[model samples]
Structure formats: C-alpha cells, structure tokens
Target: MKPQKKKYIFHPKVIKNYRGNPDLLRIHLTPEYTKVDFGYVAKDIYINGGWIRIAPETFIENKITKQRYTLVNAENIPIAPMHHYFETKKDWRYFSLIFPPIPQNDCLLNIIEVKNGTPNDFNYYNIELKMADGIELF
Candidate 1:
C-alpha cells in the first residue's frame, strides 16, 4: 500500500490590498487562498532594486463558528480559512504563496513564518511566473 499523504494547513498572516490592483498577494501561517481578510497595505522597499512589503493588520474571529478571517479587503468577505497540503517531513514543511491574477514587475511571494515554529527564517518553495506584460511574480 502507498503511504498516506500528509495534509498541511496554511494560516494566512498578511493580505495586500493593491488599491484597485487585484494581485491579491498574501503571507501567513499556511499557504492557501488569498482572501480579503488577509488584506494589507503595500510597503515600498529599497532593496533588490525595489520591492513592496505587506504586513498583517487585523484579526477577526467568528463569535459562533469560531472562524477567523484576516481582514484583507476594504470590504471584507466572509470566508472559511484554508491551507495548502503537503506530505509530512521531519523538519521541512511545504507551502503555497498566492498572488493576484494580474502581474507586477519584479514581484515575489515569500513565506514569513510557520506557526509555533521559527520566525524570520524562510525557504523558497515556488516562484511566480512572469506575465505577458513583462512583469514577473517573485
């Protein structure tokens, strides 16, 4: 019999609201969908030519269902949080970073933290492909 696949959960931390830009990029505890709850403001950085930084803003918990939403969009959408799936490893974990369908130049998605684990230490899992408009997802 084949070994059972281990399922991993993604808990989102930050969501970026591009202010009319639909490239919904997000970072967090798990790798999953980029919802409005995880929305954040884009921060300008002066590194690697230049980049945008997103930070977590608010945490909302459902009173009855106990569901939590990160509050990414100006008009919040009620969604059940989700995470990516990966086979379990002793030390390594898998995640999926999502961005909006639209492309941005020199843009990238990064995993910031792993819940109950180390912080500020990141490993690259996937790379965003470049769009037809000459912009690449980082």
Candidate 2:
C-alpha cells in the first residue's frame, strides 16, 4: 500500500491579484479531494438582481506543472446556465468546489470559471497555495 498523505485546512484565506471580487473563504486539501470554499457579497446591483453560478466545466490548473484539476462537485451553488441570485445588497452567498487532489508540492493555481476574456468571468490567476505550516486537520 502507498503511504497516506496528511490532510490540511486553510481557513480565512486570501489570494494574489484576485479579480472579480469573489472571496476565497477556505481550502481543504485531503487525500481524495481539493475542496475550495468561496463567498461573494452582493454589490452594485439592484436588490435581488445579483447572481452567480459555476460552470460544470470549471477547473483549477497547477501553474508550474501545467496540470489541470477539473471540478468534480460543488455545494450550495448552481451549475451555470442556472444561477443563485442575491436577495439584497448585503447578502452573501457561500459555496464550495471540489476537485481532484492537487499535488501538495504544487503551490500555484488558476481557478478558471471561463476563458472568455471578460471581467465578469470568475477567473482567479496565480493563487498562491502556501502549505508551509498549514493547520493539519488529520
């Protein structure tokens, strides 16, 4: 049997040069999955008009290895063509995405919702995943 890898959790996280203003809330790296939690607060839109969704094909790519980790599942969010709308300007919607485990050695990734070159796309580039002294969960 192969040696098991330890699990890690990073809470209250931040990323470099994040675009489109979606908040990255947490990240859990486990033997089986790389889970990312996200949050978006309603802003600059009419009440109940702000909306968000994740494309079924959304993915995370390891920057150095050029390896793509495709999205496997999501929670508390809708797959695109569908959307989760905000009830008010102060409302915050939280969701999570699960992908195949990225090698712990890989420290940078791009979370791409799409590559259409629009500012509205939720594409976060060069997100630094510093595992150094990360809080081990298990």
Candidate 3:
C-alpha cells in the first residue's frame, strides 16, 4: 500500500531559557520537557554584537479562545532566520527560525533579547508545529 506517514504525536514547544553567564537565565519550562511554565521573573543576560540573548516566556496558545499569544506587543514581527549564515557566521551558535504555519492554535513563544538589533526584530529561537493536550502539561 505504502501510504502511511504521520509522526510527532504532539511533542514540541521547547524553551531552555539558557543557563549561563551573568546569572538570570533559569526557566525550567515543562511539558514533558519544555512547553513553557518556568514562571519567569529573573532577568539579566544580554549581548548584541557577540550574540547571546536567552529570554524565553513567550506566548501563542489559543485553544478555543484560551488565548496566550505574544510577540511582546507585536507590531509587524517576521524575522525569518533559518540560514543566512546568521549574517556570515559569528561562530554560529545554535540558530532556528522558519515560522509560517499556524492554524492548529496553541502557541506561546518569545525571545526578549534586546539591544536594538533591528530587522523588524522578533527575537529568536524557534519551533512549534504541534503540541496540545490539557494546557501546560507538566
């Protein structure tokens, strides 16, 4: 028959809030691993020219109007950064962002690292295709 293709049974929405440098980067979002719920508040960890901004507590969960979408007051966010070599490589340190699929509802993403690195800046880090069960399952 050869007509079967379906995996990733709801398991993706990570946010490892980073755990290094100058303190204040500790969020243990859990949803079996990382679905967000670390309860943010500890701030302090930024680097613009050297690349280092690990702030995650973002949002995008709309399970039938249970709304939880955020881009920090969104105003034209769309900074697709999959590979431009992150601007010709700066030692490339983990990069991911290719958003363009949202219709299943349930999104809550963020990356509030600022130093004015404009480009319609929407922060960084990415992933969230499917993952829903009963709200914040940790």
Q: All predictions: root-mean-square deviation over Cα?
A: 17.4, 2.5, 14.3
Q: Residue by residue across 20-86, what tens digits does model 1's lDDT show?
A: 2223333322223332223222222322222222333333333333433443432232222422222
lDDT of 2 by residue, 100-134 (tens): 98777638778888865467777777777778846
Give lDDT: candidate 1, residue 103.
17
TM-score against native, each model: 0.19, 0.85, 0.25
**Predicted candidate 3, C-alpha RMSD:** 14.3
Ranking by TM-score: 2, 3, 1
Per-prediction tally of clashes: 20, 0, 6
Best by lDDT: 2
Write down the worst ten-residue block by lDDT for model 1: 86-95
Model 3: worst 10 consecutive residues (lDDT sum):
31-40
What digit string (tens of lDDT, one per residue) describes model 3 on residues 48-134? Answer: 223333323334344444544333321112232311222222233332222222333345444333434343223334443334442
Indicate the residue-level lDDT of 48 in model 3.
25
Model 3 residue 25 distance off true place after TM-score fit, in angstroms: 22
lDDT-based ranking: 2, 3, 1
Model 2, position 12: C-alpha lDDT score: 37
